[model samples]
Target chain A: MRAGERAYQALRADIVEWRLLPGQVLGEVELSERLGISRTPVREALSRLTADGLTEPHSGRGVVVATISAEDVRSLYEFRDSLDCRAAELAARRGDPEVFRALAGELLEALEGLTSDDDPDHASYYELVQRMDAAIDEAAANPFLRQAQTGVRLHLARVRKLSKSDPRRLASAAVEHQRIAQAIADGDPALAIATTRVHLSNALQHALNTKELAPVRPAAS
Target chain B: MRAGERAYQALRADIVEWRLLPGQVLGEVELSERLGISRTPVREALSRLTADGLTEPHSGRGVVVATISAEDVRSLYEFRDSLDCRAAELAARRGDPEVFRALAGELLEALEGLTSDDDPDHASYYELVQRMDAAIDEAAANPFLRQAQTGVRLHLARVRKLSKSDPRRLASAAVEHQRIAQAIADGDPALAIATTRVHLSNALQHALNTKELAPVRPAAS
Candidate 1:
């Protein structure tokens, strides 16, 4: 990979996975030293991060990693509640029942595997959830709403990654996804909305209670 | 922040609010003199404003405030629907029944006063709506949603201000607000969502069809 691209990916991963925390100053000098890259590449990386909204300009201090505050999580989920519920409702109205029916089945099977197996790999489960999201977005069919979903989901991924991986959440989310998929497949917008809201509230609580957020933002980092 | 950013924010707000009209020249020396700052900071401010889409570079001159067109209105309203509907639904679910019920009552009474009187003062009616907004924000209890509202409403206020005032919207909005407040007061989230959606769409149509939006964003003003 190009030096800039390599630096950008490393910095982005560090930030996303919480090794590089919110409000941590991304000084070009320190980053170049730490990443073993030149300042030009580091600058490029920082610029990319800023564009991603993962970092922001600090007064005279250069750029600092953008925060996903407790309030931000709550606010994001609140926004997600709006976006996801509408998507689910539209899915119920216009989605292919078979597509959602299949997702519902996969979600149930994923839940069983998630709860019973010792395997910690959740990639498949998460992928299944993404598929369901894609299905819902496709069903929603409104270009405007779809565009909003894309933006919301991007923020959500960043926020969600800050959480300590709890196996418990994966199991609960499996059940929630199953219910939402089933509701959509059943062509029940109200039910889909109810299920989606329940999931969002639970997710918000999970995000708020995440160990990473418990201390709130780091004071001196 | 720095003098540059402060200048940028002030200039941006003035443009957004139309205090600085589109096509208005933003000469660095003039702004610096007005803001009691140096030209460098003013230049920095103008450059940042250009990047932010709040202003644009003029040939052989400095930046000027950006213009709004029909496309801008459409885009803003589309985004608003997603936000407002979610806020209304959340208010219905979490708001105190008495508060929204009282808002509903006030709206009805305001409608009577508004239509019955020859008086043109809409301050009372607008204040009532703002009170409802505050009540809804409080009930929703999501700081994130509330914050989003603050920004979006700023944009909305700016957009609405540019419009030629029509008396018809007030009477129509009163009925809509009453329905929405009553729905929330009755703890009917779906009804609140439906009513909020209806209001946004109607508002969008009114904004689009209004002649003010067409000729207001003048070229070479």
Candidate 2:
């Protein structure tokens, strides 16, 4: 991979995972020194991040990580519903039935494995979700739609890190994925869209409740 | 505006208006000389265009304008329907009704101005359409959706230039915009979405027919 692309991916991951917190200043020199790269790549990465809305140019402060508010979260989910539901519907119409059927089976197994509350299995679960997202993007076969979904998902990933994962929500989310997978496997566009809507609504409600319980900070320390 | 931004906008407009046709090579030296700018700003503009999917890198060929096939146009419309319909629905739910009502009135006036077959009033009509799009984006009030729409519209603008304008289609398109504006003014989300669907369907049909009648070619000369 190119140095600039590598820097971009690493910085994006850090931002999404909250390692690089909101409102944090992203100086090209500082980032380049820390990442062991030249300033040019760091500058390139920051420009891409700005385009992604993960960071913005600030007066007298260069570029800083973008801050999210409660209203931002609300608007984000509303936008997600529009793109994701449509993606699900398209996947149902054009996806490989066998691939989705297999995904449905794996989701069921993942749900069963989530019985132990102590072990969240979050990593594996998120991996499954990523795989499902890739499948849907491939199945939809629209580069424009795929690009839009990717842009939304970047912010969504950052927002997801804002809330602590609840075991109950995780289990329910797995079930929701299963239903979505089954609907796509069956080539039922309406059912896929409906299920996607339900999943997003539940996820949004959970995020809102969690945010109210534990307010986010800028992570200055 | 910064030199890079000025270059980016100028190049983007040229590409969208078909002055810089698909498959054309975009050498930095050539564009910089033509635009009376430095190679630095031209490079920045090229990168931005690549991000917008207007130009792509070719091995041993440098960067070239991306081509649009018939299938590409079809997929573009399909993707537009998903995002645009959702945007219209959100505009109806959250937009200023007075703004849309006034827009509906303007669209009606524009329709009247299109009576002569020879006098298409294409430029003014497109400007009005752009105004409506901006209004809907502002009314939707979702930055993520707005960003997605902006990205999609970049490509949509390029694809639009592929077809020759028809006066009859232009008149009907104005009426369709009026219906959408009226629905948004009435705060009817479902109606707005439905009207947007009809408009997209008709527009796609027209584009397809036009493409079949007159094929697009890269402006090598």
Candidate with best DockQ: 2
Local accuracy of candidate 2 as per-residue lDDT tens digits, A81-141:
9878888999999999999999999999988778765455478888999999999999999
Candidate 1 C-alpha error for residue A31, in Å:
4.0
Name the runs in model 1 displaced over 4 angstroms.
A1-10, A32-75, A96-102, A105-119, A142-155, A162-172, A201-212, A215-221, B1-79, B89-139, B150-164, B178-198, B208-221
List lDDT for all candidates, in order.
0.80, 0.88
Q: How do the residues B132-155 of candidate 1 rate in per-residue lDDT, one tens digit apiece?
A: 999999998876566556656765
For all predictions in the order shown, the interface RMSD in Å is 4.6, 1.1
Best lDDT among the predictions, by candidate number: 2
Tens digit per residue, CA lDDT, model 1, A153-177: 7678877876777888879988998
Off by over 4 Å in 2: A117-121, A212-214, A219-221, B117-121, B212-221
